[model samples]
Target: MFLRLSPRHGSRLLTRIYSAVAARRCPSCSAPLPTALPTCPSCSHIEPLPSTLSYHDIFGLPSVPNPFCVNTQTLKARFLQAQKICHPDAWSGKGKKEHDIAAAQSALLNKAYQTLLSPLQRANYILAQQGLSESETDRLGDTELIMEVMEAREELEEATSGEAVELARQRNRDRINRTQKILEKLIGERRWDDAKKAAVELKYWETIENAVKDLE
Candidate 1:
């Protein structure tokens, strides 16, 4: 007979398995790293273990296409922790190689945080990870979407009053929301072609939104 474990027990089992499979150790002093801590306690080393960890891994997020459900508070906290560890100033007394590594890691962490912070950017990052290219994304062939964006821009350009402009802005925001849902569905299905097209269409709507803001 198979025994089902409780949630707490399952979580503990997963943690133990992860620890055994991918435990991090300090490169400086070869000490095991505590959860989410940046430095080695034994040697006071400020650098993290050297590994090709993805952005999701760096942020302790699930490796999924839609990171929209990520908690903003948790993301901010993790980003601050990582920055504190990888900041160049923290490595001032270290050697040149270590300092350089710290700077590079800090830059990467910043990029990851910024990318995942914005829904559109996170979608684009997911597409890129799936081997989609800018040129492919730019070559959007959805005639209906193209016409809709054109009409929206024309509406924005012809608006004469603040109310009209606000209405246009609201319409664009609605379009963004709709397109984001489509993108999310496509990504969930691993439909890279359709997802890229949706992402490009969303970019156009975003540009329209910004233009409306300028008019306001």
Candidate 2:
């Protein structure tokens, strides 16, 4: 079991035994798996593992927060350090057991890094904590705003000069920044349903992010 908790007795147990059940390596060369799996660095073999594994356990964090905010850069650094240790390069000339361990660790690291990175992604993480999965596509009540974002993307994509795209980019950036403030306030109030409602709108802001990239 990944986690076993008993709050009344204050008893708990967590296991880091992913290496045992998962075959994380190149079948031919026995090369350890990399974070971006299906492509082994050592032997260039494709080996993809199932996603059922927990990202939290992959990085060795308490399943829930306690004096640890999700945005803590220190925790992020620790995660990166864990990934470094598990990188296949560290297992040079190691035995099969060692190689497998390294591969499992690397895969966990990649998944963990991806989980903790973005605010929307973080919202989904919080949703998972609540036994909910945030919708992959957000629905907004403001169809006009949605259409606006769509048009902006098309315009930005076709813009001939950086200045033209920059104008659209800045406008969308301001909108996203404003929406982010709303998101933070809702989360602070623990108004998740409202936060999720806003998140659907915020998904449109992601289009703005894409617009920014197009400008660049």
Candidate 3:
């Protein structure tokens, strides 16, 4: 029979296992890297960020935890710390080659931070890891839900007053929050199919939010 692991224990075990893999040699000086992170703390060398590293790994977080559970304050601090070391401007005088590496490293970090910071994007990323990309998410089958969103969009088009826009925003926000909770449960349970559906629902809500604009 296969062994069963408690979620907490499993997370710790996975973190340790991944951390070992994450620590790599700095290609320049052969120094051990804390992660595949672009900067080498030992030699002040900057390397290209590896695509194989997960966004969570870049920030030294356990990859198995709910992606949305990351601490905002902690993530921000880690991002700032990484940026200070590998931002393109930091390597401007080093050499064109090093500066190019730093530029790519900085771009990757920004993408990772932005992905981890947004709940919808985080869900999409996690799902993508399971081979269920957002683009591949099956079309949502909830007819009534589709109708509700369509109605909301139509209402938004005619919305003239600040109060009306604020109300619409609140409704969209609530819908997004509920979908997030559903995603958390489905993902934590490893129900990839259902989690993908929830993520698709979230994407619709986010798109609607983007259409909301300042009242003229």
Q: On residues 13-84, what C-alpha lDDT tens digit does candidate 1 reach at each position?
A: 655444344446765777876534345546757544334455666767765555445666888888897787
Ranking by TM-score: 3, 1, 2
TM-score of 3: 0.79
**Pairs of colliding residues, candidate 3:** none
Residue 120 Cα positional deviation in candidate 3, in Å, after optimal superposition: 1.4
Candidate 2 local Cα displacement, residue 81, angstroms: 1.8
Which portions of model 1 miss their true places by more than 4 Å? Answer: 1-42, 46-51, 65-69
Q: Which candidate achieves the best lDDT against the true structure?
A: 3
Please give the RMSD of candidate 1 to the true structure. Answer: 6.9
Backbone N/Cα/C clashes per model: 0, 0, 0
Task: Rank the models by lDDT, top first.
Answer: 3, 1, 2
lDDT of 2 by residue, 1-216 (tens): 545457522221212334332334556687665432333556644333434444554444444432113554755876776566557777756666667867776766676677665666666666555566676564776778668767867877776887977887787787777777787777667777777776666677776677578557
- List pairs with backbone clashes in candidate 2: none
Among the numbered candidates, top TM-score falls to: 3
How accurate locally, in lDDT, is each candidate? 0.74, 0.60, 0.79
Residue 95 displacement (Å), model 1 = 2.9
Model 3 misplacement above 4 A:
1-38, 136-138, 214-216
